[model samples]
Target: MTTTPARRRALVVRGGWDGHKPVEATDMFVPFLEDSGFDVRIEDSNAVYADREEMDRTDLIVQCVTMSEISPEALAGLIGAVERGTGLAGWHGGIADSYRNSSDYLQLIGGQFVTHPARHPDQREGGEADNFLCYTVDVTDLGRTHEIMSGVEDFTLRTEQYWVLTDDLNDVLATTTHPVQPYHPWHRPVTTPAVWTRAWGKGRVFVATPGHSLPVLRDTSVRTIIERGMLWASRTASE
Candidate 1:
């Protein structure tokens, strides 16, 4: 008799601000997760966090909620689940920008989105420059050997470069530098993590800061990193 492998269960909780296009963003990745052998369940409401039984059975949680308040009961359930080994992964403001009022949530995530300095648009008519800045993402030496970042190399990206407030516990995989432009107050370039991973209790946490827009998320390199990061966080190998 042949033995069947147990399907990994994933719960994607989306919806907070429509600006993040949480529904559309979650739609983009659901198929990938399904193809990766996960039995995926999606909830447009954060209320799902209150279901301790469901949370306990879940193997992974992919959250796309941005700037929303999670109820105390639900928050406790989610935190307890992750602490007990349910993996968590998210990109951009979904994880970092959510739950601004909860210090415990911020500590669990290991970072928070502070700001993205806007670039000055050229006064010249049709000059082609806007707040979106172009920068390079360089993989760190440690990242070169990590499963999530192994094949990814230094690449240039034109998008919102996030200035995040991070903790020392993160295992940084890649980084980008923010140049001192006239639009910003800083006199010197500020370097920040573009991709990183950390452990929360027995669960793994993964974050990437480049997915502000659909096009950015669709970028080949960005997509690859997120896909790999998700698998790594879930403690699964791609099929």
Candidate 2:
């Protein structure tokens, strides 16, 4: 007799800063995950992370919480789950800037958002639009051949260019440079990782720094990359 395979479980943990539109952003991918054969669940708090039973069975986690506090227990649970091979994936401040206070969390993702420098004093006061500027996302030599970046060429985007603090452990796929402006404090232009992945224990982690807003996330290239990233970071993905 033929039997069907068990569906993978995907847990979406979202909610922190609404400006990131955590709910809306995650909602965009829920249907896609379901169609991909995942049994999806959405939780608005980090409490779900501490549920060992659910976490142990989770095949993937898509988190969009930004600049929030995570309890010690919840943080530990999350670390344990990932160390045990539950895939983790996210974009922008959602994952990078999520917990400013947890070093352990930072260690898991391998990167953090320092800032998205504004070009002008006037722009700083105007909001996210003020930080919006034209910039190019250059795919690295390795990225050109990577599954997540395959067929995606160097592309330019008009949005907030993130200045991140990342380590050498990541397998960086794409990068963007923040040019020194007269109004900015930096002496020389600096480049930061825009897309990257990390292998932790048996788990896979994927992060993209470009999804600052829905418009940015909706960009054809950006959307495709993130979709591919989620799949690549899932537990079932081939190593």
Candidate 3:
């Protein structure tokens, strides 16, 4: 008799401020993963894993939450699962900007989104907003050679150009830029790493700064990027 491989499961957690668009945005990933053959388990609260033991069976974790304090035990449980090789993937401030109050959290995730230099406090994509920028991103690293970006040509996307960023142990997979304050030390002419990947432990991290809205996430290029990111970071055999 032939043995069947177990189906992979994905844990999707969503919550926090509405501005993050957690509900609508994360919902976009549900069907997407299903199409990929993953048995997705969607949860709106961290309490779902409160059992403290449920993390054992989970294979991948995708956080869509903006900002929500987790119990020490709960936080540790989540991190522990990822450390054990479960995948951790998300976009925008949801994952990168998450747990701002926890230094350990920052260390585990790799980077954070401090600010957007060229972006005004209130603006829309392609509006009359000054310095609003968008450009085609070049995926030159080994990440592009992989199946996720395979056949994905250099694509164009319009996001409030991220002028505020930090450069450390980051693998810049894609980039773009907008002008910032001329007097400041970093007020030079350059585009930044708009999409990147980093490592934490035995696990992996995939983050994209372009998911400012459902429309952007829904774009053909953006969707492919995030999907590939999930598979890349997840602890699945395909990775």
Candidate 4:
């Protein structure tokens, strides 16, 4: 007799800053996860992280919360879960800009959002659109061969180009350059990781710095990368 295979479980935790539109952003991917044969569960709070019983059963985590505070217990549970083999994947501020207070979280993800320098002089008054700029995302040599980035040519975007602080631990897949302009104080052009992955024990982590808005997320290349990333980061039930 043949036995049925168990469906993989995906936990989506989203909330925090409204500017990132966490709800709408995450909603875009739920259908994809379902189609991919995942048993998807979504929570608006990070408090779910502390539920070790659920976390232990999770195969992948898709987080979209931005600038939110996670309790110590929940944070610890999250770290423990990932270290134990639960995959983590997110984009833009949803992952990079969330939990600023936790250095441990930063260490796990291997990157953090610093700022997005405004491109237009007239629009530099702190609105979201002020930082929008036209830039190219160049794939790295390693990216040319990696499963997540292979065959994906360098692409350009007219959106927020994130200036992120990252470490050498990340396996960077693509990068975008922040050009030096007279309006910004920085003297030299800064090139930051646009997409990357990290290996945390048995779990995998995937992050892309381009999903600042729905339009950006909807970009053909961006959407493809994120979809690939979620699949790549998910843990197999047998594993």
lDDT of each prediction vs. the true structure?
A: 0.86, 0.92, 0.73, 0.92
What C-alpha lDDT does candidate 2 achieve relative to the native structure?
A: 0.92
Lowest summed-lDDT stretch of 10 residues in model 3?
124-133
Alpha carbon lDDT at 210, candidate 4: 96
- Against the true structure, candidate 3 reaches a TM-score of 0.83
Candidate 3 residue 210 C-alpha distance from true site, Å: 1.1
For candidate 4, write residues 42-118 as lDDT tens digits.
99999999999999999999999899899999999899999999999999999999999999999999999999877
Give one digit per residue, the lDDT tens place, for model 3 in 48-119: 655556676677789987666777776888778778777888888788777778776676676667765544
Residue pairs of candidate 2 with colliding backbone atoms: none
After superposing candidate 4, which stretches have Cα over 4 Å from the reference? 1-3, 123-126
So what's the TM-score on candidate 2? Answer: 0.96
Task: Give, for candidate 2, the lowest lDDT window spanning 10 residues.
Answer: 119-128
Clashing pairs in 4: none
Q: Compared with the true structure, what per-residue lDDT tens digits does model 2 show for residues 1-239?
A: 99887789999999999999999999999999999889999999998999999999999999999999999999999999998999999999999999999999999999999988776786566666888889999999989999999999999999888888989989999999988889888899999999999998889999999998998989999999999999888898342
TM-score of each: 0.93, 0.96, 0.83, 0.96
Candidate 1: stretches off by over 4 Å: 121-130, 235-239
lDDT score, residue 99, model 1? 90
